[model samples]
Target: MPTQQSEPLPLGDTIQRYGLVSRILHWSMAALLLWQFLGMGLKLTLGRTPLVSFFTGSHQMVGTVLFVLILARVIWTIANRRHRPAHGDGLLGLAARAGHMALYLVMLIVPAAAILRAYGSERVFAPFGFQIFPAQQPEIGWMVGIGDALHGELGWLMLALIAGHVVMVGLHQAMWRDGTLQRMAGRPRG
Candidate 1:
């Protein structure tokens, strides 16, 4: 009789759970988003103190990085859509799906609005000492207006959604006793 050999773990997602790439993207974005929120929260609470400045000093660069990561995550998600875990059935599942979609929407929009604001500003949009968007000659009022209107408002909205998401996950763990978090945080299923 031949001996059985185990298969190698996949880097992409599988039906049972998220794989290395998906987990990396998910956790990375989570951590970065937390940083952004913390910085902004401190700014709001503490005014322009050095402590707030310390966190916010890299805000633009971090936001730019987050935008790129969001794009990559979206592409990766689409590619892995068939293989990843399902949201499950019935009302809760539908709500989960809708909530996730909204989260993605706001994630894309928040940085996008800021980028638009940066593009329309008289100041050059440079992060990490490199220029990305050049300053508008007369400053595009419409672009600036849209960005100004949406960026902060939608950001706070995103934060609220994130809090809700975490609460739901906690419910899953405590009440449902489901391994929902394991989909992203646990080791890949064999």
Candidate 2:
């Protein structure tokens, strides 16, 4: 009798579903983005309460981490573009593609703006107790201005986009009975 060997799990995406690396990046970013939104929402509703303070205190660091993750995700996405599931052919598919592009654009922009502001601010940009950007003596007005203008506004916009994304996923599951969520969240297809 011959011994049989099981195949290894995929690290990159396949036509059927996202692989381990893509799933990890997707879920991890989802969690971090949720934290960011929750903190900001609390700050808006409750002002300076201890709970809000706790969330806000870690905001910069979390944002920095998100920035890095988004960069990695972009790279990974480009690498796996040819192997991933298709968006389908139709207006719906076009919308899906457009929606995802918008999400990626805002995701990249939100943190990048904040980082630019931090780099140009009078105070040092220290996250996790280490300085990545030193304080500017005079402060760069344009950098700070662009960041201040875009960060909060675009953040809210991104939240709205995220809500739409979730609603669409629900629609796919409920109306179409499609395994759209499974592409990213479900167990690997055998």
- The residue-by-residue lDDT of candidate 1 on 25-105, one tens digit each, is 889999999999999999999999999999999999999999999999999999999998898899999999999999999
TM-score of 2: 0.94
Q: Per-residue CA lDDT of candidate 2, range 59-166, in tens?
A: 999999999999999999999999998887899999999999999999999999999999999999999898889999999999999999999999999999999999
Q: In candidate 1, which residue pairs clash?
A: none
Off by over 4 Å in 2: 1-8, 188-190
TM-scores for all candidates? 0.93, 0.94
lDDT (Cα atoms) of all candidates against the true structure? 0.91, 0.92
Evaluated with TM-score, which candidate comes out highest?
2
Among all windows of 10 consecutive residues in model 2, the one with the lowest summed lDDT is 181-190
C-alpha root-mean-square deviation, candidate 2: 3.0
Worst 10 residues of 1 by lDDT: 181-190
